[model samples]
Target: MRFSTGLAAASVLMLASAAWAQEAAPVVASVSAPASEWRAVAAENLLVIDTDKGRVLVELAPEVAPGHVERIRLLAGRGFFDNLLWHRVIDHFMAQTGDPLGSGEGQSPYPDLKAEFTFRRDSQTPFTAVAAPAGSVVGFLRSLPVQSQPDALMAKMEGGRVSAWGLYCPGVAGMARDDAPDSANSQFFLMRQPYPSLEKRYTIWGRVVSGLDVVRALKFSPNPDGIVTGPDRMTRVRVASDLPEAERPAVQVLDTNSARFRALADAARQAKGADFSVCDIDLPVQVAGAPAA
Candidate 1:
């Protein structure tokens, strides 16, 4: 679906009230932790994806790609992500989404970010990197798991500027676009599979933090034109705090800049990828406070 910059999307579910209306039940519901609880924390290192199945927590990278994190948070706060759908899926490659139009030919009101190619290659970039077999089809770059497509790799490697980028791993979330970098407005993609050609070429922004099963459950439909398909309808998307008593994604994001988070990152470094990828990185989240269902 294309981003309708002018509108505000709120959280909603698709229950047929007429068919399922029942007596008032004790509705213990899930809700996102209040932003007021966040206390103006940094962006990277903490992200949450509230999906129908459950909440997917993601650690963002504001230290590296600060602009994108700011813009994305702004949009999400304004309820921009509501009702969108993942549109393109390529088996063993990537699952793409973020077209507000549901047509894979749309964008948001925001401008494209200036490419953050490399941020000095900080192995300690707070990304929970994984170990990839050296001979595997795709491998990890200093813990940044790669999709390993030759073309995409070449593109990313061509410009070795010290810019930052989001590594495309299973469940890695990023922006999708036409050939031009400036064209990437709202469309995005997720790596259900891997595609290395993307490397530093596209706007590598964020990764999936949790609930990959919900992503896995998305349909693999391709359009006649190819390179796209609409994902399940996003009935509504609002910041967890904005949701009603019963319908918010339940989870708490670990403070990315917290001392505890730094400790966890260091611990992960010593740990091997028990089949972990960039998407496997867990940004901390927990169900907080009372339930509103």
Candidate 2:
């Protein structure tokens, strides 16, 4: 199903402010982190989508939405997403696809997935906080931005863990469903900009580590329904691990837990002042030895 129509106006306003902030903020010099501070993304968890626009690389977060990740992996491996049209797209919002029928109503023969809007996070979870406001802590878990209850509350919970959910930052990937919370099937969307209102209401499975510009360049529909007359299609989709070794792209992300990352986050917070948000920070990514887009 489509997102709540009420969000469209709010999204436009938010996008305007975000654009202004991006233009006004001083550019921070790229940090040179130690090699130890760089972590290579697992090939199996990296999704490569070659669209008519360009190549988009997404780093899947199974820890947050295992079921959805598995579904994506299975379908991509089976080439189910190949040539699937991006049927619905909204500027400064998101692009929706993954329907084999090229219409919003289709799905894989597999069953619909249950909602995974929240996950339990314990001390073992790799979380690096950028901001702690009152009762909630906002941070990054790998490449995905997240918000969760304070770590102190974990001890009070039954399983020594607290509930956490992914933030709908720009480039976030989320499964789309009908009004029913558990109706998510094959369709999903890639965020074009930040929209915090979707937090905890949708299951976030991954975040784009590279080529977000390509996502933003997708042709958007002028129709209020977001249905495109002629849409761009996914030429091919595959898990990095499934590709031949020589063809696979080597990807590395700046570790969020590293001191260099903390310094970068601090710089961003200071620059944005009260308007600061974890989404304002774009983690550094390095890609090497990949076939040309």
- Predicted structure with the largest lDDT when compared to the true one: 2
lDDT of each: 0.47, 0.86
Per-residue C-alpha lDDT of model 1 across residues 1-293, encoded as one tens digit per residue: 23211100100110222122122111122334445432232233444455554555444555555666666677766767776765555444455555666666676777876655444333333333233335322323322344332322333554532223446555666655555455556566655544434567566665654555666666765432224433564444444454454654445455444555444544554443343333333444454533322
User: Can you give the lDDT of residue 165 in candidate 1?
Assistant: 47
User: Whole-model lDDT, candidate 2?
Assistant: 0.86
Model 2 stretches astray by more than 4 angstroms? 1-28
Q: How accurate is candidate 1 locally (lDDT)?
A: 0.47
Please give the lDDT score at residue 145 for candidate 2.
Answer: 93
For model 2, state the Cα shift of residue 70 in Å.
0.7
